[model samples]
Target chain A: MAALSIKDLTAIAKKTKESMQISAQGPHTKITVHMGTCGIAAGAQKVMDSFKEVLEIVDKKDVILTYSGCAGLCSNEPMVTIERYGEKPIKYINITPKIAREIMKQHVQKGNPLKEYIIAKGYENIV
Target chain B: MGDSTMSKETKKKEKTQTIPDLNSVPFFGRQILIALRNRGRINPESIDEYIAHDGYQALAKGLTKLKPTDIVEQIKQSSLRGRGGGGFDTGRKWASAAKATGEPKYVICNADEGDPGAYMDRSIIEADPHSVIEGMALCGRAIGSTVGYVYIRAEYPLARKILGHALEQARAYGLLGENILDSDFSFDIFIKQGAGAFVCGESSALRASIEGNVGEPTPKYDHATEKGLWKKPTVLNNVESFANVPPIILKGAQWFSAMGTEHSKGTKVFSLVGKIVNTGLIEVLMGTTLRDIIFEIGGGIPDGKAFKAVQTGGPSGGCIPESLLDMSVDFEELSKAGSMMGSGGMIVMDEDTCMVNVAKYFIEFCNSESCGKCISCRDGSEAMLEILTRISEGKGKEEDITLLEELSNAIKEASLCGLGTSLPNPVLSTLRYFKEEYQEHIVHKRCPAGVCKALITFTVLEKNCTKCGVCFKNCPYEAITWKKKEIAVINQNQCKKCGICYEVCKFKAIERK
Candidate 1:
């Protein structure tokens, strides 16, 4: 019942920046779909299917769909790692249809690494 | 410390893989155990390949004539120990579960392999599900259990899907469900996927996970063999341990125990990795020396780097110094040297590896994965990681190393589960074997291995420069600019010291100090 004001606008702006950071990660061209058992069990298979279908429709079969082992965080399955040219691979967790589409349009089409959905980032720096 | 790298296939540069020669190893082409026999050979998911290699023979044999205790006696004679780190006697685990005072007896395969760098259990579960099923069915018939559960990791999606199909196939073949092998004993197995808690690999916690409880661990000392899985008699054997049963029953105990050392019998699978040229899976006999594995099988360290340490048994294991490279790899001896054979995961480290970085890495792993169940585990690991991080960053004082030792001792002694108790392994081992390296970081403010970015700096040695322009192209930050009158010079402030410039420059114009 409260009126919208500066605090609400500030929060919205903060959330938007966070979302933009996720979408503008890098010039990621290679998409490593974590088709690990945890990913598939958590509907990663479907997400992979949609990405593949989208890529195929857009005539981008050249995009690699490499698979990797579990990322160790089993709670957030169906993880996706996207790497662009000259950038570190950022992993997106709990990926779903709507989110995947947003990632495809905003990041994949443009050259962003998708930072908001990132469960872990800068793996090269950490590991 | 010499290179264990086998001769590379220079002709096939694209492959980048070296094929090994069996004669160079101790037990290269012998197949004694049914579980691991098909490991490196078959395409895991293909049931046809598994069936072609006498896959269900043990189950068939069990269905025909062998009594349950007879199978247990066979294992007893084999003197097999559980491969899940603790060398607990396997036959006795089966026997106690057999004698448990309960009605709904059960058999469980502890497939929750959470040890970092150790995938021995996952490889088997992913490769040979039939072998584990056969082994469990044998145990079920012996203990009069009608149900079995494979508490695997949720991260192991491939193994889960493959094992699901294998169970259905086994039941269809009358090898599972009611009246297995067309005999009076009927057994069934189901899957319980664990939410990756390092402690869930423990028996009691694994049992609770199956019963839909959170994967948190507690020390009830209830003896899982007596009061496990729904307060009934349950036998939980690690994947590698259960995978050994069919072979023991099939080949007899004497033959099984003949290969390994006097105390530790039979072959062991070691996931050989690290700074080596040839890194892969190797199954060597127990008595084989570390030198043989690193050189003969693993093909030694890559890039002519000197061997520094070999971290065995994951975070729970200790680092054996280069002097002990020839030490015999067995259960009790490894423990005596301040390390235990917690599932065989051997990660070889070369000279370029910073000991401080190694300790930091293991500490980070323990800190993040520490369940936060105990105070010592939660805080001790955080403190150790902070100290190691500070030390690696050249901000360490001499007293920090002493504090690290104190924290490791406290966590190892006071923590609840094996994850906490053994979490100090890397810290203690590095402190024991590589104290000088830590001293170098603290006193000299230099990383001997040139790995710690904070401690290392890149400089141009004018005498070594040849004006090759290689370093110019290799610098990621473009910090190298041409010297107005001679070869290019490096901007020390701008240089990240990634070592790529040093590596690419044939004349070694760039130096890491």
Candidate 2:
């Protein structure tokens, strides 16, 4: 290994960016569970567990699970953001474990995001 | 020169790339994540994820292109100050260390955040440890130091674990150790675990603790930049301050400077806790008002309780009343309002929170954390704590008010470090803003907020009670007795005054008199 040069670092950054773009295009779905203190207070942990259980049941291979801090509007906590590749992200608020499982079953498995629990649509660039 | 300018312009252009639907993002309207840019967006454990989000690119840029002096100049131009309570200029500290003659100069990131309700440092470290590491490396390069130390508190186990992993990852990828980015400069970092002393958050005290001495603050007659850590010139900046470096270097000073107030540049991350509805870490522009932070970002106080006051800084900080809610939260502005912005602990106290008790609680914290170095801090804190305790317990004499103030001022005038100096703030500020409450506590012998346990009595109201068995089951000492379809009665004798029945009462039946 030729002592990682600046050029190599830049190239790696470029590769990662390109991979990010590719992931954004298709073949993956990203789930962002807000785990800020407020979210946790509103039962985000159980919501996250629900997401994990539902996702496992659906068994989607290309799903990405990540946690985010508070989104400021903590009133609508236990917030989850679901982004399907090549589409705008949807944000669901005031989510329970049952709602999370419903979301996983209806949205992740069948390409349809639940509208009732959603506070906002096309919230992809929010963070 | 033209080609470099073109690249710089392009970098600037790229920096301005906006995240679409920022308005739609639930809380993005009020939040500006500069220091916390990669916080929730990236996987903190993966260096690749960090890099993808423009992480170590700044380090690479600083190393390959900019000289050490140039990086320092850029920091100076940006007007970036410390976020670890002092609000001192980051560039000046680094420049002095660089100017100081030493064989192996040192850079230290002070992550020993010990504010009672503050976890801003720990959160940043846990969420984005690589950013902190990158910031440290950039500081080392700027200050001509080849080694750095991250003195984080042992209480933050998760942050420590993540930071340790981040260091290992950086070393493995050659981002740390042996000529980073293949430049002439080779920088490495080590973690110095603090023994959970609040005083160790002080600069020289932290330096002393790292050197295996008792964690006590020393008088700073000489600047730490000129003499620190084994008598070597050292640059010490806080976790948040270091985390801000990579962004400042990646973007220009102008970008960082553009976000905050005229004097206080860049964003501040506050752990908005206490009686607020949304209690979490929030990063907002420096000039953002306390009203916005408390009401807007914090979702106001929970359960419709009226907002009484918001306490900024920490145990060493003052309580700003609702009257000063509109005041812009910055270093200078906070000081003008009788409080220094001590490490971004914004604790929102509601109407139920008694200011005297708040003052007493903080004084107790200060008394415990005092290094016992000075007579005023040691004895004065104990005395102040004693008076506050007496006043809170309804044993306050009319003269106790003036006595507390006198002792608080004495401690403030004669203290070795910031901890001791700021010890008087909570009491003084509460006295200034909420004097009526103190008068009530002292002259009237009443706790207006129902917070001082001794001053308030818990009673079960028959009119409102719906035969609720909740309080009966919830009371720790079985203080409440209830038959079905009958009002619950609280046994004054058995009541430990724990207020569990009052809290658990569903019907507004439990009254505090």
TM-score of 1: 0.75
Could you say which candidate leads in TM-score?
2
lDDT of 1 by residue, A1-127 (tens): 2322223334544553342232333222666665544456788778877787687766463354445434333345677777654544556778996777777876667544455676443332110
Please, what are the lDDT tens digits per residue for candidate 1 over residues B1-513?
A: 133223232333222112222332222332133346765334355444455555656665665667878777778789898888988888888888877889899899888887667777776776577888878888888787889999888887778887898887766655576655445777889888888877788777777788888777788678877888888988888888888887677667897888789999887777677777555455667877888888766667887878998999888888988888788888988888778888888888999889889888988988998879899999999999889999989999999889999999999899988888988999899999999999999999999999999988887788988877778877899999874456888888898778888788787677888
Each model's DockQ? 0.02, 0.29
> lDDT, candidate 1, residue B376?
99
Classify candidate 2 by CAPRI docking class.
Answer: acceptable
Return the top candidate by DockQ: 2
